[model samples]
Target: MMSVAPSELESPETRLAPDTPWVCLVWNDPINLMSYVTYVFMQYFGYSREKAESLMWDVHTKGRAVVNTGGREQMERDATAMHEYGLWATVQKDD
Candidate 1:
């Protein structure tokens, strides 16, 4: 077996690539009402009713919506917030 150098171990800072943006995605599901979805969007995101309704409609018709975009931690928080509101949500790195 070969000996490994201590430098080969990566720090947390080194593990993350710089400038990667993450997005929060809300998925369409049969359980939640469209109006409620819009309400949740407005409540959580502080979006105007019109904007929230638009996003809700997009998820209703298109099957998903990119609700928010930011750093990974922010996206994760948004996803968790959506879950708290009973919406199916996820986070992914923005391409």
Candidate 2:
């Protein structure tokens, strides 16, 4: 690989900023039970029982809930983990 001179490298101050915040949304589905949803939130994100239950209620009654918020990569990971746990999930840039 060709080596670049120090001047050719992007300086920290000139580099692009870190990625914008993103969110993982868990959608309501008939397959998973409410208790299981709460458990998934608590287990995966280490959310408190009350917080998990509140999010679960939002998913149940509102059709979806923002389960996580962070950088795009982390939000994607959260969505994938939710999928692995058999929950419907998606990631999007937070408004």
Per-residue lDDT of model 2, residues 1-95, tens digit only: 99999877777765666457899999999889999999999999999999999999999999999999898899899999999999999999888
lDDT of 2: 0.93
- The list of candidate 1 runs beyond 4 A from truth reads 1-18
Clashes of each: 0, 0
* TM-score of every model versus the real structure: 0.80, 0.80
TM-score of 2: 0.80
List model 1 lDDT by residue over 1-95, tens digit each. 88877678566677775677899999999999998999999999999999999999999999999999999999999999999989999999888
Q: For model 2, what is the error of residue 49's alpha carbon versus the real structure, in angstroms, after optimal superposition?
A: 0.4
Candidates' C-alpha lDDT:
0.93, 0.93
